[model samples]
Target: ITYRLVKEYNLMINILRAEVVANKAGELIMDIEGSEQDIAEAIDFTAHEGIEFRILKSGITLDEERCVHCGACTSVCPSGALTLRRDDWSLVFAPEKCFACELCVKSCPVRAIVAVMHLNGTVLAG
Candidate 1:
C-alpha cells in the first residue's frame, strides 16, 4: 500500500501508528502529504482498493464551559498539546501539536476534553 502510494501517486506517507496481526486484523494511522490533486487521486485509489480511512480533525476538543483549568491534563500530555499558562495558570490547548493521543481525555477530571473524529466530513462528538 505504501509502495503504491509512493511510486504511483508520488505521495509521501508518514506512518504514525500501526498494528497488524498477519491476516486477522490491522490498524494503521498515518499522515499523507502531497499536492491537492495528488492527494485526491491517492484517496480515490485507496477507496477503489477498499481501504477504509478517515480524515480526522486535528486534535482533542476542550469544552471551555465545563473545564475548570485544573491542569491535570498538563502532566499526561506527551506532545505538550495541553499545558498551563505561566502567567495566569489557565490551561492552554495547542491542537496543532496534538497527535490525537487521547491521554488528556483520560486525565480530565470534568470530562471537558474529548477526542473529536470526523465521519463523512461531519464532526462526531467524541
Candidate 2:
C-alpha cells in the first residue's frame, strides 16, 4: 500500500498490493498499478524469500444471489467470517474478519455485496 510520487513532476507511481514478509514458505501476493516495466523493476529490487508477484487481470469477484446452497465461502474463507448454513437466512458478514481487502466484495458475482461508507451523516458507496 505504498505510493511513490516522482519529484518535480506530476507523475504518481502506485503499487496496488504487495507482500513484504511471511513466516511460512509460500508465494507472496502484491498488487501493482503502474507501468509494467516499473513494476518489474520494483519487484526485482528485492529477492525476498517466498515472495512472488503475479499481475492480476480482473481480480476476484463476489457472487451473491447465484450462491445458493453453496458453502464454498465457509471453506474457502481464511478468516472464518463468511459462513453458510442450510437452515440459515441471510448472509452474515462479519466486519471483524474483513480487512477491507475487498476480496469478498469481488467474490460476489451477483454484485449483492456492497461496501457502504458513512460520512457526515450521509451514506456513501465504497
Candidate 3:
C-alpha cells in the first residue's frame, strides 16, 4: 500500500503512530501529502481496498491552571510536543508538532493534558 501510494498516487506519507490490535487488525496514523486530485483518488483507491481513514486537524489542550508539571507527560510524549522548560520546569507545548497520539493525556498525573482532535464533530481522543 505504501509503495502504491508513492508510485501510483504520488503521495508522500509520514507515519506518526502505528499499533496492532487484539486480533489481526492494525491502526496507523499518518500525514499524507499530495495534490488535491491525487489525494482524493488515493482515498478512493484505499477505501475500495477496505482501508479506513480520516483526515483530521490534530491538537491538544493543556489545563495550565490544574497542571503540576511533574514531567510525566513530557516523558511519555513521543513527538516532543510536550516538554519541560529548563529555566522554570514549566511544561511547554508545541501544538504544531503534535499528532494527537494521546500518550501525554494518559500519562498526565493530574490529567491536565486533553486531546482536542475531532472528526465530523466527534472527539477522536481525550
Judging by TM-score against the true structure, name the best candidate: 1
Better of 2 and 3 by TM-score: 3
User: By how many angstroms RMSD does model 2 differ from the true structure?
Assistant: 14.3
- Candidate with the larger TM-score of 1 and 3: 1
- Model 2 C-alpha lDDT per residue in residues 23-122, reported as the tens digit of each score: 6544333333456566556555433423344443332223455555344345555676676645764465565665445556656655555555443345
**Runs off by more than 4 Å, candidate 1:** 6-38, 47-58
Candidates in order, TM-scores: namely: 0.67, 0.35, 0.60
Displacement of residue 87 (Cα, Å) in model 3 is: 1.0
Please give the TM-score that candidate 1 achieves against the real structure: 0.67
Decide which is better by lDDT, 2 or 3.
3
Deviation from native of the Cα of residue 54 in model 2, angstroms: 35
Off by over 4 Å in 2: 1-78, 86-91
Would you list the rank order by TM-score, best first?
A: 1, 3, 2
